[model samples]
Target: MDIIKKRRSVREYLDKPVEDEKIEQIVEAARLAPSSCNSQCWRFVVTKGDIKEQIIKKGLGGIVLANRWAKSAPAIIVACADLNFLTHKVGAGIKGIEYHLLDIGIAVEHLILRATELGLGTCWIGWFNEREVRKILKIPRSIKIVALITLGYPKGELELHEKQRLDLKKILFWNKYGNCEG
Candidate 1:
């Protein structure tokens, strides 16, 4: 809970390089996350130095100007998902549910929590030029790009932004929707 409370979408980052070991540990957490029907489709591309610059230039330009802040991050993780799994495809057709997306969301949370535990800062970036990213990263057309995560040490002391959430009374129910009492 403390780690959950400490987690924030950090945009500013230190210039120092993140240790590879720490990055591995964070991804390990995601690797262990539960996926729909065990269809573990998540793939990650970790970029740094020159490649990171190329990605920032080619993939984050134009309308995604707000994400320019990610340039300060020492590492950018490109989260991808292989949509070749039959279960997710069949589930989507039958139930109109993209289970792979749910799987990716759960996996990303695990990654963020682990980064928080390691005293590293992270931001989940959903806005970007997917086609540009695919071209720059050499990602095949078959895979779906889920999101990008900027990772690095926070610059100076970490100041958490206040998160406003709905109260349990408003969001929770005994069993049915809007039913508070059993």
Candidate 2:
């Protein structure tokens, strides 16, 4: 919870490069995330070098103008979902819920929290040209570009501020929908 409180969506990053070992640690966290029916259907593409540049500039720079700052980070992680997972597909069709999407979210959260614990700044990015990203990575049409995350050491000192959120009473309930009195 302390690490969660300390994290923020940092847009500015220092020019320093993140170590390969730290990157490995970040991915390992995602690997440990829970998946529905044990059907792990996600992919994480950690981009750097020229390909990373193309992804940030050509893929997202024009479409998401407000997020151009992501280019400053030393690395970007793209989360992809392979729809070929049979268990999740069957379960989703039967239950009318997309388990793969939920699995991806859980994995991404683990990745972000691990990055924060490692003293790295990160921002969860969802607004981008998905088609462009798929083209850049040569990802098949069967795969989905779930999310993009920017990561690096923050450019300057950032002090933690109180997080803004609705009170627990408004979001949590006992057994029923209007059971907030609990």
How do the residues 59-87 of candidate 2 rate in per-residue lDDT, one tens digit apiece?
A: 78775878888999999999988898888
**On a 0 to 1 TM-score scale, where does candidate 1 land against the true structure?**
0.94
- The best candidate by lDDT is 1
* lDDT of every predicted structure (CA atoms): 0.91, 0.88
TM-score of each: 0.94, 0.92
State residue 81's C-alpha deviation in candidate 1, in Å. 0.6
lDDT of 1 at 112: 93
For candidate 1, write residues 1-182 as lDDT tens digits: 77888888899998899999999999999999999988899999999999899888878899998899999999999999999999998999999999999999999999999998999999999999999999888999889999999999998655455568887788877757885453
Report how far off residue 69 is in candidate 1 (Å): 0.5
| Local lDDT at 146 for model 1 | 90
